[model samples]
Every structure is written in C-alpha cells, then in structure tokens.
Target: MADELAFKRWKSLEPGIRKKLESNVFCRKCGVTTIVDYEVEYTNSQFTLKGSCQKCHGPVARVVD
Candidate 1:
C-alpha cells in the first residue's frame, strides 16, 4: 500500500533530477562513468538506483538523497 504510493511518487520525479541521478555513478569494473540504465527502488525508506556498467557489465548502485 504505502510502497505503491512511494513508487508512484518516484515515478513523478522531474526528468532533470532523474537524469542527474542516472549520470552520477562510476563503474569500478569498467573504470569509467558509463551507466546506461537506472532502476529506481525504495528500500528502508531510502531511494536507490540500481544499474549496470555499460562497458564491463558490473553492478552499480547509487543512493538518492
């Protein structure tokens, strides 16, 4: 119930905020800032972006503040 509401609110975030969040990750395995996709999720009352490194396919995650 509440989870769904939070998810919906996340979906309504501004495009610029999403873009900034999606672009601010460095891929350790690839040694580059190449994050192609961001999977936004809410956990423990915090939002996170789960993505993969485009060059090396390594896991990348960033906490949204």
Candidate 2:
C-alpha cells in the first residue's frame, strides 16, 4: 500500500492488529529508516518503541506498518 494508506490503515486497525503488525513497524531514526530488532510493547492504547538511530545518534519517529 501507499505510505499514506498504510499509515491510515494502521491507525484504523484495532489493538490486536497493531500487535500483529509490530514486526513491520520501523524507526525513522537518523537519516535512514530501520527496523527494530527487539519486541515492541503495547499498553494503554499506545506503543512504546525502543530503538536507536542507525546513521546518527538523534531520535527517530516510530512508524506503524
């Protein structure tokens, strides 16, 4: 799907769907988007993604897939 549609679909999905799609989520860290190696935790209707930037030490955006 297109990036916009993908993001919309992700947002429209239920919590269970979010859990299943966690593997596809990526971290927009540094100048590159990288997949997180560790498992993501979902709670309180929100996700706390723990990952680092691949190119720089700056923070990254948590993207859902």
Residue pairs in steric clash, candidate 1?
none
Top candidate when judged by TM-score against the true structure: 1
Backbone Cα, N, C clashes tallied per candidate: 0, 0
Please give the range of 10 consecutive residues that has the lowest summed lDDT in model 1.
30-39
- Scored against the true structure, residue 20 in model 2 reaches a CA lDDT of 58
Question: How do all models score by TM-score?
Answer: 0.66, 0.31
> Model 2: runs farther than 4 Å from truth?
1-32, 35-39, 44-46, 61-65
Which sections of candidate 1 miss by over 4 Å? Answer: 1-7, 31-34
What is the C-alpha lDDT profile of model 1 across 25-59, one tens digit per residue? Answer: 77776554546665667877678767787777789
Poorest 10 consecutive residues by lDDT, candidate 2: 30-39
Residue range 1-65, candidate 2, lDDT tens digits:
34454445446778776555444444444344443433344444444455544545444445332
Model 1 per-residue lDDT at 50: 73
Record all residue pairs in model 2 with backbone atoms less than 3 Å apart, i.e. clashing: none
Error of 1 at 13 (Å): 0.8
